[model samples]
Target: MPTQVIQAQPSTNAFSGFIQFWKDVKAVAQPYWYPNDSGDRAFSDVIRSWGMLFLLVLLIIALVSANLFNSFITRYLLDIIIEEKNPSKFSDTLVLFGLALVLVTLLSGFSKLLRKKIALDWYQWLNNKILSKYLNSRAYYKINFQSNIDNPDQRLSQEIEPIASNALSLSANLLEKILEMAGFLIILWSISQSVALILVTYTVIGNLIAVFLTQELNKINREELEAKADYTYCLTHLRTHAESVAFFRGEKQESNIIDRRFSNLIKNAKRKIDWEKNNEIFNRGYQAVIQIFPYIVFGPLQIKGEIDFGEISQASICCYFFANALGDLINEFGNSGRFSSYVERLSEFSDALKSVTKQPENVSTIKTVEENHLAFESVTLQTPNYEQVIVENLSLSVQPGEGLLIVGPSGRGKSSLLRAIAGLWNAGTGRLVRPPLEEVLFLPQRPYIILGTLREQLLYPNTNRQITDAELKDFLQQVNLQNLLSRVDGFDTEVPWENILSVGEQQRLAFARLLVTRPSFTILDEATSALDLKNEGSLYQQLQETKTTFISVGHRESLFDYHQWVLELSQDSSWQLVTVQDYRNKNTSITKTTGNTQLKIDSFLKDKFQTKLENSIGEGLSHKEMNALTSYSLSTIRSKASKGESITTNDGFIYRYNKDPKVLKWVMD
Candidate 1:
């Protein structure tokens, strides 16, 4: 999960760098400020935002002016105390100084408060904007394959707020410090232009150093952000696959994986620390040397009686404020590396969202058409990357109220075909005709457990369906999960259904959903694989009872009883669709792995399909005899009986049997 570091180009041109910086800034900020294309953000909102910002600007100006005024007042108060030494005069000037301090404090606090308020508002709008694109056009899913943009969840959840908040902080700090620097420079100018010019030269040199150092900080900040994302994602991956790890007893392997990521994070943290240390040393040294500028220029003047001692004191205060203001500006510039890092990241994320969400123009992809029935017309499905063809030049259709089962050898695109039908994969040339997605329900092997009440679990994909308590209980009973209600508080109770229920139980619960919503067309992807034949048959019976047109992907021959037709996909990309009976007979020929010859499975089962005519008895059939008679191998019979399914023998020696110790059972067709 560790993201690859993108090195900053050290020789990047100044003009080109400014151009890129402006593009990143505009991409991130313009949508919030401009009403056009921001459908959700209104013009009135824009006006109000600009108005608040204007007030904030005024507040900053007022705050800086108050600081300058107080500096002069402190000088006057000192002159009175030192020269006049009269308590009455000093008391009046001291009161004036105290009032000035109060003004400065109020202005400073209000400005900061306003700045935060504006920043928060911008964050709200930008989060929603990015979130919309992330969810739109399945970008949330598609963005994962894009390796360049890592940890979108981290970006959306953590990085987004910083863009708005830091942009405001950077601007406000830059504005306030610049104002202070300018005001102090004017104060110093009145005293001596030569001294003011010297200080200006120092400020210019300091800015040049900050610019160079900030570039290095930019690289460090970027790596730190990426490393943190990688570390956080590793922890999340462990949580998700905790069960798999426990099953394999892979704690050591998992620990090593996490440790590797942690080491990278720690390494990046160390580099950042080193950079901060060097930057801090430079900052302190720069400030230490600037402290004596006033003494160098005006200390001799005060001794010569050219100016009052008070003027000397005022000059030193002005120099301190001036240097401190310039230092704050330089510090902010250095910190802009972090700001620019965030800006570039957020801008790239936004652009990537836009790119992935956009529907490709004039691209060759499968076109989906909504209709009352399901069909594929000359549909050739390819993997999303177009790297390999799943099935080529294929055509098939499922009639209304009919069931179609897709079967194939392992890795023959059986599941991929279903994905194409569901509109999840549509990379190849095709026209897929199916019912509207809302009317279709897809149940995969692993049922998705939404975070909500038990009722929501059953009523998923359509939670608003009003099913009475009695009706819900009936649905549960139909799936043989009536006992589920006893274990829970009620149908409305919320629990982590996944961990609370076993795989078989989860599958049955998914069938319970089929009963609740009863979608017009259901597509199941080995939905009942975890369940035994008895449970699987029970669910499929309910599925047939619902009379919904369904397509199922599974390897079990028991699925033959539920579906009307079988669409077998061969490894060579050839396909054949026929009745379930014909498919059962035909499949024995399709696979040569077992043997050269195939038993006519239907010919053997058709004559002995009956199980209710009489109860099975005796040592029904020997393993070899049964394989010869019913074309059902001993392994198949053992597999069937292990799951406790009813057995029918072809010899008419036994009809149906369960727990009959003498009989070797095989499930009936």
Candidate 2:
């Protein structure tokens, strides 16, 4: 898959952007709050959620009202100080203010707690809902073909909680601030109408500017999200392919890739910080200027004996609060931009999943039928996209207790046929008759070692099937993993099985699963590739004893002894099925016996290099001769020599002794 550095553009129309953001919020929120038939949603859960929200709103109202009461109390205390100047009345008024303060604090705390509780519940439900859809109908597997959807794991693990939490925070903040604004504005109106009207004009202008700034912020937040995902995916890719990178000594190249990704992330972060710097200046400046408006309006009135200092102070306090509320709204508008980005991303992910879950109506797909055995009837297979035909009208079947080995040159669609049997691909014209998937087990080239305890590893895909530890050890011993228990504590010990087990050991352990499962039909795609002849033979012998019909994709000549039929595919989308003995006789080039071990046709090509490159008289081999005899192409040979693997003379020759090349394989004892 190609790497995608997706950048989102700012919405051109600010009003339309807000309208879309609101619709997106409803789309995201509906699944959780309004009960849907999905397993993740419940009517009872919805009711409980609404009840919590209802209580939260009541607390917010109480807190807002108490704050309004406190502002009025501050005005009353000021009037007593500047006008009455009675110490006993002032002390009593202070007690009332203190009581109101305690009530507001209590309301504020509970309101916050309830908001968090609701968001926490929302996070769990949304995560579960998305996860179910992601895993359903093999959407997780099919989604990989989509390059547009990047870093799904990052989206699932990191992006989900923020959606839940931020939604609540943005909504509650907007609600509380709006209510406070209305109350303070009412206070301003009662004290002085002119000042309140001027403040309202200032608020409208501030909001217009906020909408434009926030739209820009929305673009930045989206870019930042993708940048972070890209950088995270880069690190994860390095970790997954660490062994391959180490073998190639690709640290410099890998580091360059990581640095590039990280730099992109840093660039987005810096851009956001810059936008925030400008946004803060606007927000603070708007509030700072509002601080003097009330004093300016009423200062001349006090000189004319129309009002006292207490009235001026009260009007100023109300004006300050009203502007502060508007300032908070501007900040929330910025956060709403980030909120918009989250909602947009998750909506895209969910829509993609729903789409891929359904089959394409217009496209022709191979029909599947579940039967007692395996067979392909007049099957013409194509790639998933129907880009190329793999085989034309191919027909074959395996008997109830027989083995069929698929052999072909590399890239001849051998494994692609197994995929058809597994029902992973079906974009073609044919009828694929096979046993129920539950009764068929597929072992790929690299066996999947699931994360679990030693016992769980052995009994994967059916861990609930009870089996004695002693019997499991017997199965392990059958696969030549007898000392595995000694290395670990026992069957219950859980380690990183993939890291701890060698490729050969992991393959053996995969075969050990066959013994445990004993499925009626089995498909092996180079399942024993990592195992030596001894272990391969032992496992194949065990498989034969199970009396299960199996189809294997293997190039080994020795594998012919284990199977009755050979299915050979050609690069030109042609195939021929014949008896194993006849196949061996007809294609002598494919099967070569090297001592007791059989070398694959490609390996036989490499084995000849031992004799061909032999420096019998201590004479160097020319580049042409080395390139002709070795498995690697001339381009590959030149690349390796250029990288200091070999020192060649100006004449393009490498000197060596006996049958050994100048470069020797380093074996760690």
Winning model by TM-score: 1
lDDT of each: 0.79, 0.81
Looking at model 2, which ten-residue stretch has the lowest summed lDDT? 660-669
- After superposing candidate 1, which stretches have Cα over 4 Å from the reference? 1-12, 38-40, 144-148, 203-285, 385-387, 468-502, 589-618, 622-628, 633-654, 658-669
Local accuracy of candidate 2 as per-residue lDDT tens digits, 1-669 = 112224335689989877877777777898788756566477788889999999999999999899888877888898899788999999999999999999988898999999999999999989998999999988787777533687789789988899999989988989999998999889889887878898899877887788788889888987998999899988999999999999999999999999999999999999999999999998788777777777788989988989877778777778787777786787787676567778888877887787667777767888999999999998999877678898888899899989999988888799999988988878799899999999998899999998889888888889998999889989999999999898999888889988888988989988989899899988999998887666777788889999999999987665876899998888888889999868755654333444578654456645654444453233444445554433334443444443335433222445332224663321111
Candidate 2 matches the true fold with a TM-score of 0.79
How much does each candidate deviate from the true structure in C-alpha RMSD? Answer: 5.5, 10.1
Candidate 2: regions farther than 4 A off: 1-24, 36-40, 146-148, 203-286, 299-310, 589-669
Q: What residue pairs clash in candidate 1, if any at all?
A: none
